[model samples]
Target chain A: MNRDTVIPPLNAIFQDVFDDPSLEVSDDMTAPDVEGWDSLSHVNLIVAVEKEFKIRLTTAEVRGLSNVGDFIALISRKAT
Target chain B: MIAQKTASLDYGRLVRESRKLRPDGAHQNIRVAILSDAASQQFVPLLKTLFHENCVNAEIYEGAFDAIELEALNPASGLYEFLPGVIVLANCTQALRSRYYEHKGDDFLETASQRVQRIWDALQRHSSARVIQCNYPLPYERQFGNYDLKVPQSLYSVTAELNSRIALYARQRSNALVCDVEAIASYLGRKHWFDERLWAFSKAFCHLDHLPYLAQSLVEMVLSSMGRVVKCVILDLDNTLWGGVVGDDGPLGIAIGPHGDGEAFYHFQQYILSLKKRGILLAVCSKNNRETAIQPFLENPDMVLKYEDITVFVANWENKAGNIRAIRDTLEIGLDSMVFLDDNPFERNLVRELLPGVIVPELPEDPADYVRAICELNLFETSSFSLEDTARSELYRQEAGRRELQTSFTSIDEYLQSLEMKIEVARFDPAAVPRIAQLIQRSNQFNLTTHRYNEAECETMMRDEANYLPLYARLSDRFGDHGLISVVILNVSAAEMEIRDWLMSCRVLARGVEQYLMTRVVAVALEKGVSRISGHYIPTAKNAMVKDFFAQFGFEKVLETDGGSRWHLDPTAYRPPTIYITEKQRTS
Candidate 1:
């Protein structure tokens, strides 16, 4: 695994996603923390994670993933 | 002879270890947005399990269709709030179809292809993500079919036509894949899909169990086939025992074999056997006394599958996952190679949570359907079955003997020497061109550099250039002769000798064939006075297994382009990995 790959899902999500490419990260952050992080963006992040893992996530799990850590735990759970 | 490895693997159940998912399931985030109705909430869990269950970092946002926030998806701006691999529009009615259909033009398949392409191209430009477009499900046939008159197409046909277009579109491109929602809905028998007990149906618009399962299945199949090969099918016995336990019921009493109730279970076993015949390995992981489970073979007259049929078995209940892991080891295959099918929902869920790579087929209430659904479910992948598929099961049985054959040896070299492996390196001849061409296209894992060629193409390339010299290597050892194990396409020009295509079958890897082939390249180049010999590495999702190939051969890196990596080997300084026996002839 590359060291650069260990970047938290959200930070990577933000950099790969958001228009505010200058987006920096802190764990305390939420989607609400950034601009343009609406419902579609939320789903877009889910798609990004699916692309990243080559695995699928359900809408409920996507909806239930509350924080960056929660998402991290969820993603790490599926990582081979 | 010990030389040939004839063990065949099911392309499915071949476990894929988590790597940086540049292509398949990536380790990063998959931007996903679901556009559906509040009605879809019930089915979301199943969808998530299907699509997101194994994915580590996916963020899915769902809302009423109007809530999609399409403004954020402008690709021309080259700016996006998110990048989604797949964007699904569900719970859509015919009215939505009209709008989508209006934009569709000319080749209906092309229309769907371009729509997906535009979305993928747009998403890819901004962030590395793909797209999946789901065709709206058909309304109940009773209602939708009655309205069509002039066009004479049923609503179901319309849905199918649309979905077919999408499937074709995705099939044509690597960057995008289509999600067949219409087909999924159709698979559910008419009454079952419209108003199931799990769903809370509104009089206005009917729906069935959760949308998540559908979404999840779509995502999972798409990702698995993106490159991962599912190689094996690991199954269990007990209450998963044909509706009766084998140990308790005894072989005769067990709910299996050609009879009512029993026939359902027996047919299920037969279905599994059919898969095995097609090269999907069938292994048993049960909790019966080893001898008792083994007895079914000898005593049970009605049984269609025998002890020899299965590749691996773990009868102890010591955690199904542990047994599954053991099976993976025994086969020298990967966890992804197996899909665990136990009638017990708990065991299924447990394995799903623990070893996520092992696909756990959903246990439906009816046992009769299990056998058939598994046979028909093409979701995970589609592949061209080769002639090798017919003999795969027996091939693995022989491989097991090879393993037992290993225990008798003390040292690795002794084991190799005992096999007395012999290799024949012959100049390419007209008679072998067809098979050689097939080898170039089919060879994957053991390939040092995978360069694909067709029979006619190989023939043309060979005759066209004095620079092109191709050779195929055939090997025979203790086990048997592996027809032709390797092929090399060389460009022998005076200025620069190049290795255009160099590939070897995975069966012969770790056997020092790379050294033999490289030495041939060096010797030929040296004689030609082509001071420089070069090779290239084209990065494919599966071929990443060979990135450091030339480096291992001591080739100096010359250039790295987005196309692939290039390397140079000085004709003067090169040594081959030679120890095995060899026979060679050079054609003028």
Candidate 2:
């Protein structure tokens, strides 16, 4: 599947993570803006993000990223 | 739900990067001011250890003795200034337990308590500040003698005992809680409690060195238990537990076949059962049809808890929170106690906002994390756990006794006799130490003060003449022996007595043990020629069970301080409930 296939999965992840509907999302939205992007929470979030994109984020990469956009870049970089 | 949202956020990111557009104001941060006179050496480690960017974006306001002396913090005189989310009486530990002080026992404890109270009361008066009272941590082995040197510990040891007295005193103030820092510190080994790398101590246990995890954990404890009870624990089925949807795959086709995926789910199920066993009622709110959702319990023999194990079942087409509200109404408990756990993120979040008090723990992708998160919740930690804990599930299972409340035998008196309920109200003696100790640690939800005393401390309080005196009201209703279900600690000051702490177990809450203990305590107060009897209601996450306690006793509201609601009663005006039977005897 092309990168377009990733959109459906990413949409599902965003819907699940933020619990928002009829909404707008940008590649740059990060953990800082996310209401529940907590560390205890981040552990599972990253795991879900990785499994959905069919890619991986290093532990440091996962810890260092501050926003949602960073997650998208990391996923695209790894997936390609 | 998540897989879709993850795509939405990520897609927005791609457009912004390619289009070179950066969005503004994605996350706004809040600052939490941590006030204390603790030296940077002591406080900095705490800051570093608990420095969470997401949960609490905070600033540390390190105050000196002059800060405490400010017009803002002076309770006796100053306008009760607003307080922060967490106001830890941290430096008080050092001042009270200082090696140089050569103070007498009773006076020292009372004075320290008032001093700490002034700080807590002043801060609490502001309304926003949630106070955290910690007992002074004394390195006993280093001070008493060597690591191995043990002594015949005095009844109320200066450092530790004074801290405990302060803890009890703090409990007398509303919405103030005493974190058992002393007991936690006492258990810490050199490297276990403190982090050598960070050179910091865990606030979970106050040691010289600190770990960062302790900070987040402490914040969780402070926020979660402010003034609510976790009423119910709603659960999910299918992949959430045994790996496959029973409808799609059939009962035998499910992944819960013992050793592999089944083991993890089995352990998770058992863990949830244990929480239910502790009086946290269990309810099932699933999307599946009632018959299909319940079929697993009837057909699958490996299931740990059957359909009857659940207190409420809503398997129809309804919003998760709606189902939860119904469960709350049926159980007659609060939505706060309800902890909704579902593998689906959409369902968990729906309940979170609609019913905020209901703790909705995110079900991890892997069953292992799911199990870990449920058990390791420090907010659910009971300071005391005894025989009552393991037996709590059976007690609820047998709560068929509540049905008996409607129809009376003849009169109100006959109704009581029909349901053979036996209550053992005893003066705490050495014989009941084991059970009493457990009650002090595990009984959190209904505890008036939420204070924990070890066996040594419990024994010492009873033995002392000029200090604390404790009494336990144990109830054995028709179901079974509730074992030391209620506790009342009385602080004897000169000729007057104050009920320092009073609470009853949730299981036997409506049975009138408070009346039983109140009458007995008043009698003792009268016998001792105590001028006036008084008690205070200090609020906590779980102790809201006794919010209107003093008013219920007909005690006149004498002095309502920033600390808590206070009431006073002359022996003549006092009248406790006259019901069931009267049996009072002393055990020394």
Candidate 3:
């Protein structure tokens, strides 16, 4: 799976987590961009993302992610 | 072997359903406040959905994460102002462990117990809400491994002691209850229950998948506290009560006993009998010939539930949904109080569509799984039980016989007189507090004020007789004893008495028990030099039968609100109604 394929589903998961349908995820978009994307809900988003992609990301990998692009890149790498 | 738990709502489904909750649909309203020393945002939605499914609209208040003490201890906190009927306090092992290990405290167990008790005491002082405290889950880290159980100061040993202390404390306090988080986790596999990943990420105590189960347990507690429990179990014959259709397979052919497939039905009957013993009325509504249905109960030596066990048995060609309605009318219970179980999908769907209030549980394909399926649902959740429960079936059976006998008389008055009813009215006794509290909790339909009280609260009222007049009445006739069936609590001031609570069992309705009690209460008031006696008739969806209760006995309506109407009577002008009954009391 490429970054393009992962972005749409990942966006849907993000929308569900923040309960905001209008939320759009891009490469530069970070936690601050979303209204409810705080430290408390960040891990829920991560778990939801992991469940969605059927891949388990290491703790270090989750902490290393800077933005949506990093998350998508890691997902694409792990999916292969 | 222990039965496998029924499938729980997945995280996604729970979220979707929670979002769809609306205030307009619920038949009842309850306020709940969930306070936890862990992230609690997720529990709010889960509880909302669960209670909504139970036809109870819940308004939930979630405390800030890791702020249980702050929310509970502060009188000015929003939790107190919410004035919740039920308050749930859940603390995770992770937080307690951090507190214990970080401080190197040897008195961790004692301190933890004190902290939990302190919160309970504060809540009691600040609010009248019933408290449900969740016990700590056993920590996953087995640092001391096998030696942990032997060491008193080990984390495992300390946590275990803390859990027991919490339970013991809740047992002593009438308003406090402990929810065993460890038990729930043990049943669901501790590894699956406590997701370290979720804990690391968001400080969540349990996995999101288990939220629905936890929420279900909490909602059940609330419903039982509110007296919204399932009171009757309605069963079907043919393939349901036994393995084969009784009409096709003769009495000897039906599989029910110690043999192969018969054992399943036998076990099912045993389970139903246990529920019957707990005072849950059992009824049989089936689509079969009366003889064929009656044959199994008479001939089959292996049958666990005999003919006498059933309160109402209707085996006919009529539609089951209509039969269930007849049962509800005859039993004088709400449709929500009955649970219908049938093997056929058609019958289940029909009852579900026609009588939506009736809880029609879907039967499993395998007969062996029947008992497990229903037990897992926790359809009948009760907080208190008494000797009266054991004899409940006999009372209902006698009532049925009385109903049959009533047809012989031309008038209702003559029928009531022929029954030869006698009542024993007395003040609240220490020994009968449990039954009185149970009556207060369970009496919904015939209740005037619908005021719920537990044993401890009832004891308090008994002690404070100067201000509270707590009276109870027991009924018996030529047939059998009805046990203690009515409760009335009056608030007495300098010159007036107000009825705080008035509820009676539906079994004694129209038996002139109400009129007798009212006369006795007025007599007591007049003896105390009270000028007037006032009473309330608060209306609920189930208590419509008692709407005109106060008016029927000559109490004039003084004030009417959206909730209910108030009625008052001048003791000087009151006259007791003439009825054929004898009254007795115990001086001690």
Candidate 4:
């Protein structure tokens, strides 16, 4: 899987975790930009992303992500 | 109408369902307070959805994270202020592991268990809410490998020991129950259960995927406490309990034995028989001729469920939903309390679509998976058990015999006399407390005032000899012993004796059990020098059969309200009716 392929599914996951069907992710988007995306729902986002991509994220990898770009990049690297 | 569809425990579906739930005011309202050492935000939605499936609108309160002790010990904490009916104490293994490493002594298990007991004590002292304590799932990392079982100080050993201690302690306390988180973890496999990253990031209890199963177990316990239980299991004959069709393959030709292809059906029969011994009445509904249907039970040498074991056997070419309704009517129980098991999908779906309250579990394709499929559903959750429960089926069977004899007699009086029923009316003893409390919880139709008192409250009433006249009656006939069938609790004052709680088992109805007990109540009132005896009839959905109960007994109506009507009788003017039952002399 590449970055372009991971973006579409990751966008879907964000829309699902936040329960917002119209949600779209941008490169600079962070937790504050998304509604209902708190520390608690962030966990849900990680779980849904891991399930969708069939990859496990380590604690350091999970905590180190800063924005949507970092999330897509991490998944693209590990998903394959 | 109650939804009989089995709710999926899939985490995603439950979460979505939780978001879309609209509160139904017709549903019963329950308050639940969740106190956990880990974060409980993820669990609230799952609990709400599961309770909604059971026709309950749960008002949930999440205690502050890791503040179990702080909230329970303080009287004015938000936990008590919420006025919850159930308090769920969820102690996670990840948090316990941290506490184990920091503790300095070898008595780690003792200290850990004592901390849990102290929390239960404080909760009980402050509020009357039932406590559901979660036992820790054993950690996967075993330092000594297979030798972990030998080390008492290892984290693995301490976790296992704490689980056992939690169950043993719950057995002694009536209000406390154990939610076996370890069993659920083991069933799902421990490797998939532990998600360390999620725990590290958000202090989640388990993998978010498995949280719905945990929530389901709690919902089952809470529902049982609310007096929603499975009282009867309706089974089908064909491939369900045996290997082949009984009509096609003659009784001797059918495969149901301890060997070869029949072993699966044999084991299934054994499981059903065990349920019968536990007081769940068994009924049969099959699409076969009456003679052909019962031939297997009579002729098959290896059959585990005998003909006598079944309370009602209906074998005809009728639709299954109609037969199930007949069974429900004969048993005098709610449709929601019956479980129908049929291997054929057509019959299962027919019952599901028609009788929306009967629990029809989908049977697996193979016969061997029958027991496993039913076991996975955990459909028979209950709150109390007693010796009377074990003898319940036999009492029902004896009732069938009495019914047959009544048909042969000329009048009802002659039939009642021929049975030679003996009744023992005595004060509540320590040994009868469990059955007394169970009767109080389960008796719905015959109950005058449905005051569901727990075992501890029943014991308190038994000990207060001056204020309470808590009496239990046991009936025995030539057929069988009907154990602890009726309970009448009276409140005594200087001027009058009031009937506080009066209920009897529906099995003993029309058998003069109530008539004998009422005679005993009047005699006790006269002996106490009370001027009048008063009782109230509170109306409920199921207790309409007893609406004119006091009026039939010659009591005059004194007060009427929206709640119910009250009746009063002059003790001196009360005439004891002619009852066929003779009082049994107490041996003790």
Top TM-score: which candidate number? 4
Order the candidate numbers by lDDT, best to worst: 4, 3, 1, 2
Compared with the true structure, what per-residue lDDT tens digits does model 2 show for residues B1-588?
Answer: 001011121222322222222223452222334444343223433442232222333344444433553633555432233234555555434334442256655466456556676776667665465566655556332444442234324222545556666767755666666665555454444324432112111111232223222343444445454333454677878777577888897766676645787888888778777777776667788888888888887888888878767766678778878877866765677765566778888888888778876767666788878876665444364323356656555555455334435333556656555546666666678888777888888877776667788899889887875777788876665545666777788998667788887766676666667777788888998889888988787677777667678888888887766557888889868876766644533333
Give all TM-scores, in the order shown. 0.53, 0.39, 0.75, 0.79
B149 Cα displacement, candidate 4 (Å): 1.1
State the lDDT of candidate 3 residue by residue for B445-549, as single tens digits: 999878899999999989997788899999988877888999999898557899999999987887889888888888888788988888888888899998988
Tell me candidate 1's fraction of native contacts, as a decimal between 0 and 1. Answer: 0.00
lDDT of 4 at B21: 94
Estimate, for each residue in B1-588, the C-alpha lDDT of model 1 and write its tens digit: 000111111111111111122233564345565554334342333333333334435556554534333422554331244445555545344433444457544444345435544655555566554555566566554334455533324444555566666666666666555556656666754454443211221211223232333544455544554444566788777655355776787876777678778777788778777778887777888877887777676677877888888877568758888888877876878776677888888788888888976767676678877766664445235323566876777667555555556668997666666666677776677888988988887877655466667888888866866657877788766666667888888876558988887788787666667777678778888887877888888887677778898998789998998889999988887767645656533343
TM-score of 1: 0.53
Per-model chain A TM:
0.75, 0.68, 0.93, 0.95
List model 4 lDDT by residue over B1-588, tens digit each: 212346567777787788999899989889999999998999999999988988899999999999999999999999999999999999999999999999998999999999999999999999999999999999998889999999998999999999999999999999999999999999998899998888888899999999988998998889998988898999999888898898899998888999998999999999999999999999999999999999989988899999999988889999999999978876678998999999899999999999988999989998888999988888888878889898878766677567657768999999999999999988888889998999999999999999999999999999898899899999998888888999999998548899999999998899898888888899988898988999999999889888898887889999999899999999788887889999899998
Q: TM-score chain B for all models.
A: 0.58, 0.42, 0.71, 0.76
lDDT of 4 by residue, A1-80 (tens): 89889988888888778899999988899999988988889899888888899999988898899988898889989998
Decide which is better by TM-score, 3 or 4: 4
Off by over 4 Å in 2: A1-80, B1-216, B222-226, B353-357, B374-588
| Residue pairs that clash (backbone atoms under 3 angstroms), model 4 | none
DockQ scores of all models, one per candidate: 0.02, 0.03, 0.40, 0.72
TM-score of structure candidate 4: 0.79
